[model samples]
Target: MNYFQIWGIGFILTLSLSLSAQQVPDTGYVAHWNHPPYAMGEGPVVGVDGAHNNFHKLNAGFRAFGNVAEAGGFRVVSVDESFTEESLSDLDILVIANPLHASNLGNWQLPCPSAFTAFEIKAVDRWVKNGGRLILIADHMPFGGAAYDLGMNFGIEWENGFASIESGGFGDLFTDHFAPFTNADSINSIRTFTGSAMSSNRADVYPIIILSEGTLNLPTIAWNFDSLNTAKPLAGYYQGCWTRAEKGIVVCLGEAAGLTSQLVGPEEYPVGISTPRVGGNLGFIQDMLISLAPENDDFMEALGWLRYREKTTKVGDIPFRFQVIDWQRQPDGHIMLSGEIIGSAVSFEENEEDYFVVEVGPMESDDPNYDDRFSRWRQVSEFTFSREPIVYPD
Candidate 1:
C-alpha cells in the first residue's frame, strides 16, 4: 500500500486521535510589560491577518499574541481582506499565523496549495522592500505548505513535516544563537511542542531557535505516524529566525503555539507561553517587537558616537567616529544632524536610501584648505555606539 493509503487506514481506526488534542486560546493568560515603550494606542500599527482561512485569529486562537503586543504598546488591528497594496499601505507591521488553504481545512493530507496568490505574494514582497515589517508564523504540515510561496519570497524554505525529538516525545528545545538582535544578556532555553522546521542560507538571516541534534522530521499524514514512514534529521535547521528585507524586517517562525498561550486536550492542558517551560518566550517576544518598531526620536537623541572603519587601510585603520550632538526637525519633517568633530563643525544629509551621508577633512578647523580637502562621503546605517572612546594600540 502507498504511504497515504497505509496512514489512511490507521487514521480511520483512531479517528478521535487528532480531535482529542484540540487547542484553544487561553483566555486567562495575561502579559505584563514592566515598562511599556509607548502610551496606549500610540505605538506602531500592527495588523493581525484573519484572512486566508487562518487557524489562529486575533480574537480567537491568537488572543494572547494580540494581548502581549498591546501590552507592549502596539496598536493592534484585524485584517480581513487579502493582501494588496492598498490593504498594506497604512500598516507598519503585519502578523500572519497558521493560515490554511480551503482544501486542507479539515483534511491534513497531501495536495496542499499556496495560501496566497502570485499577485498577493508580489505585493507583499514590494511592500516589505519599501519598509513594512512582517511576522509570519507557520505551524506543522498543511500550515507550512500553505505559506510556502510567501516564505520563499523572503528566503525561507519551509519543511512541511512534523518535527519531533528522535529520542521520543514532543518539546524540542533550543538556545539563543544570536544575542545582539535581542540585546539579552542571557536567555533561557525555550521549549517547543510538535512543530515544523525551516532553513535559510542568506547572510542577513539570524537564527533565534535552531533545532538541535536527534530531532527528526517525519513526513506523514498529520496525526498519523507509523514505522513504515521514513524519517529525516533536522539538525541545524531553524524553528525561528529573522532577516532584513531591503528597508524592512521579517520574522519567520516554524511554530505558532510557542508565541501564544493555548490549552489542549479535553482537560485543558496548558501549552505555549502559558507553560512554565517557555516562560522566557514573553520577554523574547517583547524584545523582538521593540526592535522591529520604527526608531524613536528621543532614543536616537541619546546615542553617542557612531564608529566606522575605513574600507581602505590608508591611515593605519584608525576608525572614524561621528556623533549627532544636535538635530532639528524641519517644517517638511526632515531631520538635520549637526555635530562637531575634533573642533570642526560637521553636518549630515539624508541620502535617497535613508542613510546618513557626510564628508569631513582634517581635524583642525583653523586650516584654510580644510573645505577643499574634504574626504569622500560615506553612507552609515543606524547603530547605537558606546560613550567611551575606542582605543587602538600603536
Candidate 2:
C-alpha cells in the first residue's frame, strides 16, 4: 500500500499545511462520533479499556476500517453535546444504535422506559425526509435484540426480542449470564429490502448486514414473557415511518443483532469487501457514515460495497479523472454541486492532443449529462488524479 493508503495515517493529516492540525480526513466528511464505550480515543496518548473490547482510535488497525483516532477522527460524544437542530445540518448521515432492551431480564436493570418526546421524533423524521442516510445497529439485552425503539422511528419493527440461540434455552436475562450478540450483519442478504422509504433517502441505500428471517417479537420491554404470548413480527410494522415528508425515507433491519460484530475466523464468516479478518458489521457502520457525508458525486465505498458491485472503472478513463466545480458548503455543512465527465483528447491523425477534446455539457444542478457521442464538455480544473492508491493521511 502507498504511504497515504495506509489505514490510520490519512485521518490524522490535513490537506494544506496552512490549516490547523485539528483537521483530519481532509478529503471526506470529518467524522462526528457519538459512539459510547467502543470508539473513544483521541490525540497521541489515548488509553484502551479491555472491558469494552472496542477498537481504540489508534489501534483498531486500518486493515478493516481506517483508524478513526488520527483525525480526532471517529469518537464518542454525548448526543446532547454533539447534536442540535443547527448541528443536524452538519451531519451527512446518522446511525442510531439499535441495541436490544431485555427479554431475558425479569425487569429492566435500570430506568423505567426509553420514551421520546414529540419534538425529538419530529426532528428525526424530518432529517431522513430531507435526504439523510441512516444505519441502525442492534444489541440484545433490555430490548431482547428487537431494537424496537429505532425500528419504531423508521416505521419498522423487529419482533425477535430474545432468542435462545441454542435450540431451546431460557438464558436468564436480569442476570449477568446473558451474552451479547457479536456477529456482523451480512451485506449480501441485507440489500434485498425493497422499501420505498428506504430507497428514497438515497438511491444507494443498501444493507451491509442481513439478519435471520422470521425473528420473534416482544411488544413490551425486557424480562421473560409468556413463551406462548410472544408475538410474531409483522412485515408491515413500518407502515407510517414516512410519506409526504420532505425527504421521506426509512430502512430497517428485521433483527438488530445482525449488525453485531463477531471476531471469529474467516472459516466461520465473511465481510462485505472481501476483507477476511474484518466483519460485515464494521463495513455496515462505515457505509452509513459515507452515505451521510458525501463530499462529491465521487463518494467512496467500502470493500464489498454491494451497489457498485457490477460497475467498473479503468485508470485512464476521463470520467474517473473528472473534476468537480461549483461545490459549495452550505450554511448547514451539507454540499450542493454538479459534475461532468471529460473524454480523451487523443488526435490520431495530428497526434497533437495536449488537452483532450470532447464536447461535454447540458449540465445543471443534479442534471444528468449525456453527449451525442464520446463528447467532453467544459469542467473546472480543481481536481487531481490519483497516480496511485491513497493510504492513511490524517
**lDDT (0 to 1) per candidate:** 0.63, 0.29
- For candidate 1, the per-residue lDDT at 200 reads 90
Lowest-lDDT window of 10 residues in candidate 2?
Answer: 174-183
TM-score of 1: 0.69
Candidate 2 lDDT over 114-148, as tens digits, reads 33344645666676677654444333334313344
Best by TM-score: 1
Per-residue lDDT of candidate 1, residues 66-114 (tens digit): 9998987799999999999999998998999988889997888676888
TM-score, every prediction: 0.69, 0.39
Any runs in candidate 2 off by more than 4 Å, and if so which?
Answer: 1-76, 81-84, 87-89, 98-106, 109-114, 141-150, 163-228, 231-280, 296-394
Q: Worst 10-residue stretch by lDDT in candidate 1?
A: 1-10
Per-prediction tally of clashes: 0, 59
lDDT (0-100) at residue 216 of candidate 2? Answer: 35
